[model samples]
Target: MHGFAARDDVVRSGAPEDDDTVLRILVVEDDEGDAVLVREHLQDGGLPHETVWVRTVDDALSHLAASDCVLLDLGLPDAMGLGALQRVLAAGAPPVVVLTGLSDTDAGVEAVAAGAQDYLVKGDVGPDLLARAVRYAVQRRRLEDTGRALYQSLVRAAETTRLERALLPTPAVRDPRLEVRVGYRAGRDGLLGGDFYDVVERPDGTVLVMVGDVCGHGPDEAALGATLRTAWRTLVLAGIGADEILELLERVLAAERARPEIFTTVSMLAVHPDRRTADLYLAGHPVPLRLGPPSALLPAGQRGRALGIPVGGGWPAERLELGDRWRLLFYTDGLLEATVGDGTQRLGKAGLLEVADRTLRGDVETDGAVRPDEDPVVGMLLSGVRARHGGDLVDDAAVVLVGWGG
Candidate 1:
């Protein structure tokens, strides 16, 4: 108003009005003349906007609940300089543009560096300039918000990956004669579940193997699975008797589980030093498949109740005779429970046996020997399951293979 004689003409030439894109601005200015001038200029800009003027930083913050961008005068009745900016930022930090006197332009620059979207010198701004600055400030603030959100997501992803790596068990057996292979796939949620497995060779020359699944799909369940696997490894390494191991594990699960409803299904095998026999223990788990000249589920009468159930007697350990050149497969229920094709029917134990038979037949060499470098059995089984489910598994699957003599 001070520089222009007829303000009405300037308002008409600023921009075309659009009701749908009207901006709401909150102006914090103590001086009545300056406040009127700002309101007139914004109206003259012809960029449909609703302006609410406040004389103090406190009043500006109160109006912010309904306002989009804040046009703040650094010099106010209650707050001055960067102090006013700091208060506004502390209260939610919406998009902001600072108003400064021509002589205090350096302060305006500092305000921009300190999180203000943009700044303007009071005497130098026209209706068009004011509207443009407000539009650009909102855009810049949105970009910054989006970038910050993306960075946080990347950080969470990295942390989840690290946790998953820590939970996976590495084979501790050094025996070249005992070949061990494993396969694991997370569920559709893109997060690791409670499925876990471990293989360890004791000093007594016995190879201990285990595959277990806690009853859930989440970070908490995954962490619990890791704890159980670690505890089992520690007990086996410390020469804990195979007969007492499951009972001890039951105690650990009871103590460590987050809720009473949570339970774990586990299958364990302890192959003797002679590699001639092994002990099989099932805790409400699928029986281990014995791959021979014929592949089939081993005869396990009445699989034991899952761990965490109140049972007096421990899980019955059955003796398994493992002659020369034998392979045993242990896995979580996810493998057998996966849906096959587009049907509601699941790929049960029978389907798994079929897959295993196919994988073995395909992996054998013409010379009547199995390939040693790669584990085609578990790999093919997982690939087949994924293909049947259209490349998205509903649950996490884990498989471990223990073999002696070719």
Candidate 2:
């Protein structure tokens, strides 16, 4: 192969670009004479490169990942013509430049269409041309990869916007007297989860609030939550009572769920305009927390099975007198179930209540008081839960707090 043969007095492109980046290149050529020429061209081109020569396609496949680019010879014993190019590409080879014979220009053109970055005539390739081909091939392939990733990210962003709108909707109350606040945070990975909520104040000045979780996480669970939320808003707009609305919601969940094991926990309320009472419907969910005035978490009633459970029915309303001035909070389990200390125990309901007390009434026993600038808000409660978790919560948390008066 004359690998150490006399240096060919190579011709330069007159433009000596200084590039110190060493490229790792794979040469798949059975002919030793041609392999020597490829090596000489790149070595003489003044391009920093690590060249590896292989005699067959099988050897090339092993080093595909390690190589930044590949120079493939079309006329190989085992791999003939376009078949060699097809095989390399099928094995997920890197950017490739095919070496064809003088008269095989037609095959070279066909190779580019078959995914080769570029093709060169075996005898006519020069030091400059060969080096440029390798560099451009790698650069072009990298651009294509970046473009594909960006397109996929744009698609995901659009889908997320649609799902978020459905999951969190505008309040329907016209009454200025009632104040409502809500916040939602996804689980650990920042990927959206199944927790969702919706609030609508009815025409009679009665306020409706619901917070629920569709079992599991990801786009599918998120989609189901959005679907259920839309249905809840529709039922509320139609003036369905709290219990019947829940029953209908259960049927919708069972029908729409992708798997039989999938179920949903929900807490719904119908608060009267008088700002003094509400009808609560609980389904395997945490009891509502009342932070101010005449109430707190009292045993409401027999909590029914969550929607999609096999043997559950009769969703009934448990009435409550919320008093004239009250602050009521409803949330998904993500807030209370987060891990607290050494991970052996979870910051269950009691832990959350401790934080909630500090967030509102500035109880200094635990994490000190909420600063004067920070008003008592549900978002603060969510932040407090995340702090108690020691980081991001392991589950999606959704919260809605409603207040009637001072």
Candidate 3:
């Protein structure tokens, strides 16, 4: 028949005349004499505290959140022994110190093992000892909470790192004459962003490269980018034509996208085995930069609509006569959209080219063997972009530089 009490039901005492550091203590005991003794102990300790005397476990549960520490009795009318302690804990009661009778000393030990911050015998406890135990219990509980939070943060960090590695993969170029450099960084150094790129060399000696961006940021967009990138690689390896590859990729995007409004932009280009000419195809994507003796933005002629557009369109190729000593810089929009230092002007195509030029280029040695991690040009370019923006870019950024030394 016992139940929650009215707000004014609990007998309150032990609060100081004036102070904010007063600890609120909830004393859960059915015996009227023991409750009075506990309140007297709290007052005698000379500590600024507020004590709420409750008669049952039910009443204690109602006051759990308002109390800084719980002084619980092992025996209660509605609950017995550890039953009282377990219910208090399950109700999310704050730091708890179980009170026990002399015959129940073993029960007190068991209660501490179960989760009580500390335990005290009823008759033997003094005012100073009770005060010290309550303070210790509160401090210990806070440390445990902090430890739990730190552990959860570490788990999230590990997951983010794994996603970052998945989003930035190495190119699969087989030609010694072909040099590929790449870079990727998540926006705000937060969760992985929706930017992905890849390269593959065909059996016929031609190289196919691609860079793509999903419409939004965060984990969903990042996962979508991975899906599109993987599908593109599969289509290319299966010998699909560039045009058909994009069309099929659109279907993939449309099917896997998290929402109907979501879309993707892509740049797919094919470099002939001879390394003298290439065919570029853009679908609502940024134009690649032609880094020759004079670096310039390659023309994205009659661009096709971005993949997953409602009406749907095809991605046509733009033939490029990239003579000897040429490099192509392909990127997601994040690189060019950075706001200039304290201004509204964005670091657009021109700014990107300027950054590329100023950045120290670490090309492959004569041996044409540089590890993907060893490619430093892309990293420098990214650093330049961040410097220009005065901070990290607000969107996920990715860049790929394909070169041929004719």
- Best model per lDDT: 3
Ranking by lDDT: 3, 2, 1
Error of 1 at 76 (Å): 6.2
Q: Which candidate do you rate higher for TM-score, 1 or 2?
A: 2
User: What residue pairs clash in candidate 1, if any at all?
Assistant: 11-44
User: Which lDDT values do the candidates have, in the order given?
Assistant: 0.82, 0.82, 0.84
Report the C-alpha lDDT of model 3 over 32-105, residue by residue, as the tens digit: 77877888888788767888888889878889999999999999888999999999999999999999998999
Give the TM-score ranking, best first. 2, 3, 1
Q: Over the stretch 1-406, how does candidate 2's per-residue lDDT look in tens digits?
A: 2343222222122123435577888888887788888888998887778777887787778888888899999987778889999999999999999999999999999999999999999879999999999999999999999999999999989989889889877767788888888887778887788888888988888899999998898889999999999999999999987668988998899899999999999998888878798888888888988874323684578678888889946667888877778878899999888987888788887877777787776442323333344334766777787777777788888888888884
> Taking the tens digit of each residue's C-alpha lDDT, what string does model 1 give over 304-406?
8899987655678888877887999998888788887676889888877877776677742122222353356666767766665556578898899999984
Clashes by residue pair, model 2:
none
Pairs that collide, model 3: none
Q: Please report the candidate that would top TM-score against the real structure.
A: 2
The alpha-carbon lDDT assigned to residue 4 of candidate 1 equals 29
- Lowest lDDT 10-mer window, candidate 3? 362-371
Tell me model 3's lDDT, rounded to 2 decimals.
Answer: 0.84
